[model samples]
Target: MSDKLGITPACFTKLVQDLRIHTTLTDSRFIQLEQKVGFLLQALRHSDGVRKVGHRFQHSTSTIAMYIHEVVEAIMTSKLYGIYVHQPTPDEPTSGIITRNPKLQPYFGHCIGALDGTHNVFAVCSFDLLFLHLHAGSEGSAHDQKVLAWAIEKGFQIPGPVKYYLGDAGYTMSENIMVPYRGVRYHLREWIAGARSSSRETLPSTKQELFNLRHAQLRNVVERIFGVVQRKFSILTGSAPEYNYKMQAMIPLLCAFLHNHVHINDPFNRSTGKARAARMTMEAKRARLEIIYKRTEEALQNPAVAVDEEVDDPPEDQPEGLSMEATRNEISDRMWIDYLKYKDGPRRRQQVPDHLDELLLAFDHEGLLLR
Candidate 1:
């Protein structure tokens, strides 16, 4: 069931029930809501043309097209959209990643989430992988900063004056936008490989390096979320279909809504559970791991993947009222001071590389977003 729809039967059943209550979907004399949803999912899952999809479903292409659009409208206009793509409230507490991770809490307590642009989608996600905000339909070649500016003009709230989102070097740092130290060792693989080396040459030695390392780790959640959605929906992985540009633009948002639904319901296990994993041969597993790693590396390097790819740092000077640069310097200084005290203490351990590798491996597996 999940193979065809990318959603488990149990969750699908629940979703159908919700659609009945929250959406305007109703059973027709010929086709029912379940079948309508099936058409939508199948179309999204396989990326088949309307004619091919109609042939497979034994319906005319016109009927399939109408039903798919109906389903899209039902879901998009439904209350479920708000629930799945919810924004954080102003009074929302610190993200779990910050409050729970001792290394991050002190420095990033003011952070509301991470922001990045992936392909044609611009999004802000909390550290725990929840989609806090999303804007789709931007041109593929649009710069991250430009997309962000457009979103803000469209009334995308920054939540508060001090609260900000972590971005990569490509974005202009401001009071509400915190970016990593440019030209520093920021990618996880660099730090992980350094951890395995005896010389430890890649390990962070300065406050900026350490800050970038931590920034990369926390900011990685946005990248992983983008990867998860693109992997789950086949239509998103390829070129745009023949649909009109407006419908094409809505596809990413539709997938994001469903992705959030799956994440909330299936929290730990993937849509395809242990049975699928068990059927895989060891060689296939290794092949999949390599592919996952390759994709991760490509995502890190691609400017459109997470709005993150290394670039020369932006100028230090900011117009009045924009001072995230100064804020970052203060945080780095405090972090360095804490690190010195910790290193002098008896409990210091150099196991961060192993921990980093474990995180990388976890994402390589089938269920990368495990809690």
Candidate 2:
């Protein structure tokens, strides 16, 4: 044992048992090998781990390679269930999320999943940019859009087409999703401004800000999922082996399952974050607050506009659940108005022609009244 892998007897024993690293050999060799290889696997997963310790026994590096494959399989098959995805707005109103969460069926509150990809840098030994770009050998700076494409091909979580994904300008925007127009800011800024400007506690303009703010907070589930996956598995951020692209992707997916499990299932590990997430840009936040306050006040006072879920779809397969008729009856009881005629935005702010952008200016002398 001392000469074989240079691992302490106790460490070698633990490696085989704790990490479940499978080795091929006779019983005697297995026992002997465990003393060193076991310790190596432990170290690899931990911070203070080193491959060589006093050169006690020569550690076969291939053992560690096999170790990754086994662990990734265990994580995916045993830990994860129910792929979580962002719900898109229902076109016909009778599918997917509309059937899953009945409470959310009434309000279009669950609108988007922030779609953006991120990468981690790995040391490239023999590979070049081609290898790196595919994550076989890569740096942390690979673009998110590319990563997203890679993820989709690899069967990463993909929401259906009916719902729109919301993302920053860095992401590739499409008709199925909404990315901010260049120079336009997200709604979070508006929420922050609403909170800051109002002494009225719940300022009139602040309500929409508050709603949008909540949406942003909930959507950060994806971000936290990313952070935990990267932090827990340094192998992901470390150098990539030329042949290990598949392992790299699988490892992150497993880690995401673990993180979600620990937070949602384990009582011991709670959220390790600020109670309130800090907004990124303050200037934009203030402007949003003003806009939200103005818009919310307008919305509340408008009697014609109906604030209800646009559509709901009941599943055909059910024994005893809320009936579709029941849902519609409740919605019909509410007074909803249609007043967003102006929401049909001009294609390209420039294409809207000068007449529209100046329409607000036209109303300056004739204050536009809320119906």
Candidate 3:
């Protein structure tokens, strides 16, 4: 096959070999991956708006899609994001593991990337592969839990103990990933509310209030990552067709890889980080949270457990980004929290209200709304 207009044949072959990916190509199928990757990333950043050179190069849709897939696969396999899991070693610092060279981290340990799933909408594909397991429709937002599971199983699985993912209630707690703040009825919005209330100086704590503030900070990171993706790639800004799940799945991963690439090579990306960080700073973030509370704060009788007035509340340190397991899964086959809450095996028939009290308190807009 002829090479892409700008790339030499040798470089083309090397790029394909380096990617170790197979896909259908256009008449000029064997184009260098550098050229192909360049075009695909360009699409991710939407540099050309709705169309790019590939659109001008006259490649068939199939060929363009193939190149895009190959590039995505390569990025998924790459460890450029510095996301990895590391185990606590005998010589390791006990508190707050230093985020450093990912290469040295132990396989499957503590420094795991905190991943959460958000839906990515996309245009429909011409021929949907009915048998393909990946495309089951429903846009990507079926649930954050499923997204984390799929992500872990994909090119990257969550690393173990040393690295656990920090996600929200949307994700079910897993070994390598932790969903802190037990299915808080309120999440990003709650954090925003807490921040706003606290801005005026929230009363320190009854274990619940303190713990709530602590987890709020930790969970914000995952949300920030999602915001970055949507902000950078507007293609993900729309709702995807329910029929094409392949494109749906591709959007998030593609955007993620694009963000990482831009971070590495784009000069503009340098300021992007600094600017976003500044925007994400606590004060700014609370101001940006656009949540409309759902539950009304009608207080039911408090639990028999008294709020120990003199217990000396724990320090308001950032809550560790770990789902506090009621007990290890080994001790209980059910969702570990069910075990922690009750030793008896789970009965799905017995439904528990998700963060009921919390939801009511957080989302509910009775007297709490600011004038």
- All models: lDDT? 0.74, 0.35, 0.37
TM-score of 2: 0.41
Tens digit of per-residue lDDT, candidate 3, span 155-267: 34334344344444445555444444442323334443443353223322233343343333333334444445555555555454421555556666456544443443344
TM-score of each: 0.83, 0.41, 0.46
Residues forming the 10-long window of minimal summed lDDT in candidate 2: 123-132
Clash count for each candidate, listed in order shown: 0, 22, 17
The residue-by-residue lDDT of candidate 2 on 284-345, one tens digit each, is 43444445446545655675422111112211212221232233223323212111122234
**Clashing pairs in model 1, backbone N/Cα/C closer than 3 A:** none
Rank ordering of all candidates by lDDT, starting from the highest: 1, 3, 2
| lDDT score for residue 23 of model 1 | 86
Which segments of model 3 are wrong by more than 4 Å?
A: 1-35, 47-111, 120-163, 171-177, 181-186, 194-203, 239-248, 264-323, 326-371
Please list the residue runs of candidate 1 whose C-alpha ends up more than 4 Å from where it truly belongs after superposition.
188-196, 270-308, 312-317, 320-322, 347-371
